[model samples]
Target: MEQLICLEALSVILGVPIKPGSKGMSNVNELNVENLLFSTFFGNLFNGGPGKELFVDMNGFLDPQFDYDFRYCNDKSICKRGDEPYKRPCGWYRFALKVLNKYPDGNTWLGTDGWRSHSVAGEWPVSYHGTTIENAKKIVKSYYKPGDREKYGRGIYSTYDIDQAFDYSREFTSKNGKKYRVIMQNRINPKMRKVCKRQDYWLIEIPEGTSAAKEKEIVEKSFRPYGILMKQV
Candidate 1:
C-alpha cells in the first residue's frame, strides 16, 4: 500500500487530490505504478521523508515457489560505496524478486539464498544488469527477457562487476525532477553462462525449454532476477 501512498504523494505534488471513486484512480493505475514510487522515485529517500512510504513490497504477489528470506549485503569489494561515479553504492534498499522456482527443471544452483557474491559448489555466480526504470519494473512485473544487445550473439548480457553494470545503467528523471538509475541483481547459472573476463561481461546462453526462454514472454531458465536495485543519480 506504500506504493499507493506514493501515488497520493505524486498527486499532492501536482496540487490534485484523489477523490474516492473518481478518475483520480487513473493517476495511479497499474501501468505506471512503478513510475511514481515515492520511496524510490523521489529525492528524500535517505532523509526519513514521506518518500519513505514509497517502497514497493512484494508481499501478496510472491509465488509460493519463491517464498524465502533474501539477504542484505555490506561487503566492501562488490558492494562498493558511492565513491565511484558510475556505480551506485551497493546493497542499500533491495526489493527481492521471484527466482527460486523459475529454473526448477535444471539442477538447482545453490549458494544464492542471500544474493551475495560468495558461492559454494554448483552455485551460480552473482551478476548485475543495469537497465531503465521502465525495463526494470517490466521484468519485475513479468520475468527476464533475452539479451537486448546481441554483440555477444543473443544472450542475456550482464556483468560480474557492479562498475560494469553501472556503465550500462540507464538514467531517468522522476516526477520530482530527481535523476535515478535501476540495476537488476541476479545469480546466473554458470552451466549456461559465457564469461568474457577481459570485456567484463557474462553472456548467458538461452536455455532450451523456454521456446527461447518463451521469447515473447520472459521465462529464461538460464538466469533469475533476485533483487531490483535502484539509486538516485
Candidate 2:
C-alpha cells in the first residue's frame, strides 16, 4: 500500500517479513511477492486482458536517480569481459508508474505503447524504457496522496481471483454492510498443505439446496461478457 509504514501489521497479516533488512534486493531474483500481488490485481481488474490505455511521458528525460550500471555481454560472446557494464535507467520506475496509475483518485488504466512514437528504435513502449527522472519521482510522490495508500487494503490487491471467487460463491452481505463471498474450495490451489488445509475453505456457512443448473446459469451470465463457457466444477 501507499504508506509502506505499519509494515509490522502487514507482515503479521501476510506472514511475510516485510521490514527493511529482512531481505535485500539481491534476494529478489525474479518477481517478488508484491509484484505478483500487483500482477494478480491487474489481471483480475482487467479480466485477463490489458484494458484501457495509460501513457507515461518519456520525452527526453532520463532520471539520474535511477541511473545505474547494468551488466551486458560484449560482442555477443559467452565470456565475461571488461566492457560488460553499461548505464541504464532503473527498471523499478515502471513499477512506480503502475502504483501511480492505480491511485484511487483516478481510474487505473493499463500502461500501453500509445505514448511511444513510430520512429523510436525500441520495440517496446518508451514507458518500458523509462521516463524522465523528475517524472518518476513525481509518480512515486503521488502515492502519498490522501486516500491513495489505503486503496490497496480495500481488497483490490487481493491475490485471489475476486471475480471468479465471487462467481463461484454466491455473494453475501454482512450485517455491517460488508460484501464477501464464501467460496467452497481453494480456487488458487486444490491440493492443500497439511498446515493450510484448515484455512482452505471459507468458514462461513453457505446456503444449501441451490440446484447446480441454477448456479451454472448465474456463472454463465457473469462470464458472458468475457466469452467464457461455464463448465462443471
Candidate 3:
C-alpha cells in the first residue's frame, strides 16, 4: 500500500507527494504578481465572457458549450445527486475544452463517457485535477506542466472523483468579487496511467531524468486537458 497525503496542507505548501493505494488526498495555491495579472484575464473564463470564445468546436465555431438538461442528466454524476464517492458533477459548470482534438480523440466529451466504460481499450477515463490559480492559468495557456517529483514518482495528479479533486482546488475571487474554484477535467491516457487506489487517483508518470523536451512530449501523450469545470462558492 502507498502512503496518503493530507491535501489540506496544500493551502501553504505546493510540494505534493503521494503513493499508490493511499487512502487520503483528495487533491492547489497562491496569489502572486503574475497571478494578479492573470486573474484579471482569467475572469473571462468564468460563467461567461469574451475569453470563452477561444475554445472551438468540431465545426470550428466559438464556445462549444453543450446542451445539457439540469433537470435530469443521463449520467448521474452530473445530475447533482450525492450518490457516493463515484458520483458527482454537482455545482460545477463545465466549459468545453478540446485543445487539439486530433491525437487523443475519443468520445469522452462532456456528456458522453461513463465510469463503466473506463476499461474500454483506446478510451481514456475522466478525471479531475486541481491546481493553484497561477498554475491553472498557465496550464490553460501552455497545456503541460512537466510535473514534479514525488515520493512515488514524477507525474501529474488527478482523481476520478470531482469531490476529491475539489478538496485540492484553490478558490479565487473574480473581478466581480465572486469566489470560484477551478478544476481541470481530463481524459487520462489508459496506457500511461499509474493507478493510486483507495484515493482513486492516477499519477500519470513522466520518466525520471527525462530531458525537458522529452518530458514535454511524455506529459502531452500521457495527459489531455479536455474541459474546465468551475463552481461558484
Better of 1 and 3 by lDDT: 3
Give me the candidate number with maximum lDDT.
3
Candidate 2 wrong stretches, greater than 4 Å: 1-4, 21-24, 28-233
lDDT string for model 2 (1-233, tens) is: 22132222222223233333223334331222232223242232233123322121211111223222222312321211111111122211111212322333332122222222122221111111112223222322221011122322210111122233333333333333443322111111111101123221111111245465653333222110100111111
By TM-score rank, best first, the candidates go 3, 1, 2
Instruction: Give lDDT tens digits, candidate 1, residues 20-56.
Output: 2322234332122222222232222223233223232
Q: Report per-prediction Cα RMSD to one decimal.
A: 10.4, 22.9, 14.2
Question: Candidate 3's residue-wise lDDT over 1-233, tens digit each?
Answer: 00011111211122222112222323211111221222232332232332222221122211244412222334654321111133446666565442433343534333334334223334456778887777765665445564453645666777778778888788876544666677776766667778775557668777667788877677777666655565667
Question: In model 3, what is the error at residue 74, expressed in angstroms?
Answer: 12
**lDDT computed for candidate 3:** 0.50
Question: In model 1, where do residues sit more than 4 Å from their true spots?
Answer: 1-57, 61-75, 78-92, 98-118, 137-142, 146-148, 197-199, 206-219
Question: Worst 10-residue stretch by lDDT in candidate 1?
Answer: 79-88
lDDT (C-alpha) at residue 125 in model 3: 63
TM-score quality measure for candidate 1: 0.55
